[model samples]
Target chain A: DVKVTQSSRYLVKRTGEKVFLECVQDMDHENMFWYRQDPGLGLRLIYFSYDVKMKEKGDIPEGYSVSREKKERFSLILESASTNQTSMYLCASRRAVETQYFGPGTRLLVL
Target chain B: DQQVKQNSPSLSVQEGRISILNCDYTNSMFDYFLWYKKYPAEGPTFLISISSIKDKNEDGRFTVFLNKSAKHLSLHIVPSQPGDSAVYFCAASALMGAQKLVFGQGTRLTINP
Candidate 1:
C-alpha cells in the first residue's frame, strides 16, 4: 500500500511568523502537490512539483511557496503567516496518472 | 471560472437506501473523472474513476455513470451505510499523464439508521 505522511497533523502560528508543512511519500511518485481546502471554496491548488527542483504555480499560489529538494519529500512554506492563511492543507503524490494518493492533511491555524 | 461543479452542498439518506451524487463540468477537454471521499481530518481518498471513452464503471457497491454529451457524471451507492457518510469531491483531468486535477466544492453525505 502507498503511504503519504505529513509532518504535522495540526499546527498553530502567530501572525507574521514563518511556517513550514512537510510531506513525504514512500511510493516515489514523480508528481507532488499542495492544496488548501476551505468551505465553499473547495480544494484549490497552491503549488506542485513534477520533479526535484521543479515547481509550478497553481490557481492560488499567492502567499505560498513549495520546495522539492528530493523525490520523496515536498515542503510548503508560508512566507508570512496571516490569519487568512489558516486552512486545511493537503499533500498528494501521483505517478503521472490521474489517481493521487493523499496524506492525512495538516490543519493550520494562523492567529 | 469553476470548471467542476457539485450543485448540492449536502444530502441525507436512510440506511439501506440508495444514494446518488451528481457532478458537472464545463470543460469538455477533460477526459478523466474521479470521485474522492474525505473525512473531517483526513485527506481525500480515491474512491472510483471513469474514463471518457466509457459510460459506466462499477466497483462493488459503488458505480459511476458518465454522460459525455452533457459533460456530467454521477456516483451511485447501493444500500448506503453510515460508514459511507463523508464529503465527496468530484475531480477532472484533461490528460492522464499530466496528473493535474481540478476539483469541485464537494458534497457532504449523511446516513441515518
Candidate 2:
C-alpha cells in the first residue's frame, strides 16, 4: 500500500506569518502535487512537481510556492500567510499518470 | 470557464435505494474520467474510473457509465448505504502521460434511513 504523510494535521498562524506544510510519500513516486479544498471550489491544484527541482504552476498558484528537493518530500510554503489562505491543504503523489495517493489533509487557520 | 461540472450541489436518497451522481465535461480533449469520494477533513479517495474508450465499469456495488457523445458520465450505487454518503467529485484528464486532472465542484450525497 502507498503511504502519504503530512507534517501537520492542523495549524494556526497569524496574518503575515510564514508557514510551511510538508508531505512525504513512501512509494517513490516522481509526481507530487499540492491542492486546496474550499466549500464550493472543490480541490484546486496549487502547484505540482514532476521531478526534483522541477515545478509547475497549477490553476491557482499566486500566493503559494512548492519545493521538491528530494523525491520523497514536497513542501508548500506561504511567504506571508493571510486570512484568506485558511483552508484544508492536501498533498498527493503518483507515478506518471497513475492513480494519486493522498495524505490526510492539513487544516490551516490564518488569523 | 469550468471545463468539468457537476450540476447538482447535493443529493439525498433513502438507504437501500439506488443513488445516481452525474457529471459533465465541456472539453473534447478529455479522454479519462474519474470519480473520487471525500469525507469531511480527509483527502479524497479514488472511487471509480472509466477510460474514454469504454462506456461502463463496475466495482461491487458501484457502477460508472460514460456517454462519450454527450460528454457525460454517471455513477450508480446499488442499495446505497449510510457509509456511502460523502462528497463525490468528477475529474478529467486529457493527456495520457504526466496527466493533471481537472476536477468539478463536488456533489454532497446523503443517505437517509
Candidate 3:
C-alpha cells in the first residue's frame, strides 16, 4: 500500500511567523502537489512538483511556496504566516497521471 | 470563474435508498473525470473515475454516468449506507499528462439510518 505522511496533523502559529509543512511519500512518485482546502472553496492547488527541483505554481499560489529537494519528499513553506493562510493543507503524490495518494493533511491555524 | 461546479451543497437519504450527486464542468477540453470522498480532517480518497470516451462506469454499488453534450456527470450510489456519508468532490483533467485536476465545491452526503 502507498503511504503519504505529513509532518503535522495540526499546527498553530503566530502571525508573521514562518511555517513549514512537510510531506513525504513512500511510493517514489514523480509528481507531488500542495493544496489548501477552505469551506465552500473546495481544493485549490497551491503548487506542484513534477520532478526533483522542479515546481510549478497552481491556481492559488500566492503567499505560498514549495520545495522538492528529493523525489520522495515535498515541502510547503509559508514565508510569512497570516490569519488568512490558516486552513487545511493537503499534500498529494501521483505517478503517470494516476490517482493522487494524499496525506492525512495539516490543519494550520495562523493567529 | 469556476470550471467545475457541484450545485448541491448537501444531500440526505435514508439507508437502502439511492443517492445521486451531480457535477458539471465548463471546460469542454476536459478528458478525464474523477470522484473523491473525504472525511473530516482527512485527505480526499479516490472513489471512481470515467474517461471521456465512456458514457458510464460502474464499481459495485457506485455508478458514474457522463453526458458529454450536457457537460455534466453524476455519481449514483445505490442502497446508500451510513458509512458512505462523506464530502464528495468531483474533479476533471483536461490533458492526460498534465494531471492538474479542477475540482468542484463538493457535496456533503448524509445517509440516515
Local distance difference test, per candidate?
0.95, 0.93, 0.94
For model 1, what is the alpha-carbon lDDT of residue A11? 99
For model 1, chain A alone compared with the true chain A gives a TM-score of 0.98
Tens digits of per-residue lDDT, candidate 2, A1-111, equal 879999999999999999999999999999899999999898899999999999999999999999999999999999999999999999999887678778999999999
Query: Can you tell me which runs of candidate 2 are displaced by over 4 Å?
Result: none
Instruction: Summarize candidate 1's per-residue lDDT along B23-105 as a digit string, tens digits.
Output: 99999899999999999999999999999989999999999999999999999999899999999999999874557899999
- Model 2 TM-score (2 dp): 0.98
How many Å off is the CA of B6 in candidate 2?
0.7
Candidate 2 lDDT over residue span B15-80, tens digit each: 999999999999999998889999998988999998888999999999999999999999999989
> What would the DockQ be for model 3?
0.80
Query: Ranking under lDDT, best-scoring first?
Result: 1, 3, 2
Flag regions of model 1 displaced more than 4 Å.
none
Alpha-carbon deviation at B97 in model 2, angstroms: 5.6
Interface RMSD of each: 0.8, 1.0, 1.1
Candidate 3, residues B1-113, lDDT tens digits: the string is 99999999999999999999999999999988999999999999999999899999999999999999999999999989999999999999875566788899999999999
Candidate 2 residue A33 Cα shift, in angstroms, is 0.6
- Give the alpha carbon lDDT tens digit for every residue of A1-111 in model 3: 999999999999999999999999999899999999999999999999999999999999999888999999999999999999999999999886678788999999999
